[model samples]
Target: MKNLNLKSLYRQIEREYEELRRLNKRELEERKKIVYAQIPEIKEIDDLIKGIGLASAKEQIMNPSSDSLERANEGIVELRTKKEELLKNAGYERSFLDKLNSCEKCKDTGVQEDGRRCSCMENRLSRELYNVSNLSYTLQRENFNTFDLGIFSREIHKEEGISPRENMDMILKISREFIDTFKINNDMNLLFYGPTGQGKTFMINCIAKELLDKNVNVVYQTAFTLCEVMEDQKFRRNEINDIKYRQLFNADLLIVDDLGIEVTNSFTAAGIFNIINKRLLGGKKTVISTNLSPNELTKTYTDRVTSRVFQKFYPIKFFGEDLRLK
Candidate 1:
């Protein structure tokens, strides 16, 4: 993905962290109040531990010495042990007063101690991106788990010289490979071209679902919607439109479905070429599914666009009875 407005995403995650920490601190304070009330001795131990920690910091700053630091550490440890014992005696868990974290690995911070983004942060960002792209409900129904190869005819597609079911099996294998090797810059792109009602869109959804689950940023939109974003970027600027426009080039995978269905003006053609060309130059993968054949696509789009489509993308042909009609 290009340098997507990830700063905005990080900022969002940061706000979530701030909220998490605030809630955690509030909960911890409540726990401390209960524990202190029930077991005054535990409160005394905690105060001593705090005092020792403060004194240790002062000593270390004023007269740094190994022996002094060791003594302060030992005192704090002993106080903590005594506090835990007191808590346990009072029928409270030893860790009842400890601040709880939503993610212990980062302690509610989106970034780890090493300054790398935490897994939780990545997961949160993935979900946020997925939500922004608005592809959950359709993906739920069209993903691989719901893909039924049994629906395709076993009889050979004479023009293609293979049974529809057999061709789909091959396509499925290729799609899985595409997903498996997505992280690698293998320069693999796919162009699904066939008549409407074939399994092209379904396969695209399957790939999108698999990649999205693995935290790969994917933007799936029809050619009409993609062109609409371009129009929005050029004419009516808004936050949502701007984000969607940026995502066209920034998402890890850009799937343009029903390509030839869009209004083919010079602006739309130029916009489509720009997206395809920019993504190609940036090493981002794209999947385009069209109801038009290669010849028809060439007639519809610019020669440069057709050239990139043919030269760069591996064409996957879908031919069968309309599975939807079944």
Candidate 2:
């Protein structure tokens, strides 16, 4: 399969990695300064630890005797005791040395043991390559943290037979469970269908955020953007497997938001079907949000596409007014 233009992505990811490293380094330095500023005497005590390490090394080499070893050991004792004093006086822990690992080993220099990649480098690179945003416009008033069930009316109970409040609460609960218990291959493809502002997209966004946080390679795209990528793959062929199609096909969680809202064409249908079919065959988890009802899905994409989705996906239908207006 084809992949992303790695040459372009590599440089971009590198730049992002560097920027993240700078941010981390600044934060670390600020924290260290805050810590050390309180204990100006740590300068003297730390100075002594370094002296002890060097002096012990030199003496052990030159003398290699019990007396020299004992004296060096005594110096080690004094150094540790001084560190303890510094900790107590500074109101800090004795393992203030543990605080030095902002980079965990390389001190944010980005080099690990024996010149291998450091933890900081790994984290930064991961952030760059992995931190993709589906809705970068900064979605407002919607987040997993603030999703409230009380908004759905209890009247929905008698009217819809399954109260909107109860149904939405169940959906929210199960979605959270699904995210927490997410497993590759075993995860079910989900179809969220309903009117606008019915919490379909918002709920999936919550799922996407949680799944991505688990380091799952996810693509959360508005259907328009999703169709564009599909068109790009089929027409211009500017992308590679690793970048677009493959990631979407194989992502632990793939969310196509506002499906059926895109401009419809043979290309769109084929592209969407291909994605759904491929993932279904592979047992990957996919999510599609749409305004179309079950019958409408059949009319739009034919029984072949609709059946594949119905049989393979856990169909979740959302109802009610655009909750956002409420």
How many clashes show up in model 2? 6
Clashes of each: 0, 6
Alpha-carbon RMSD of each model: 7.7, 7.5
Pairs clashing within candidate 2: 2-240, 2-241, 3-240, 3-241, 157-163, 197-323
- Evaluated at residue 146, the lDDT of candidate 2 is 70
lDDT of each: 0.83, 0.69
lDDT tens string, model 1, 94-129? 888877997898999988999986767655665564
Q: Which candidate achieves the best TM-score against the true structure?
A: 1
* Alpha-carbon runs more than 4 Å astray in model 2: 1-8, 12-141, 157-159, 240-242, 261-263
- Per-residue C-alpha lDDT of model 2 across residues 148-199, encoded as one tens digit per residue: 8878876654456877887898888778767866784564778898778899
Q: For each candidate, give its TM-score against the true structure.
A: 0.67, 0.61
Off by over 4 Å in 1: 1-15, 19-134
Cα lDDT of model 1 overall?
0.83
The per-residue C-alpha lDDT of model 1 at residue 138 equals: 84
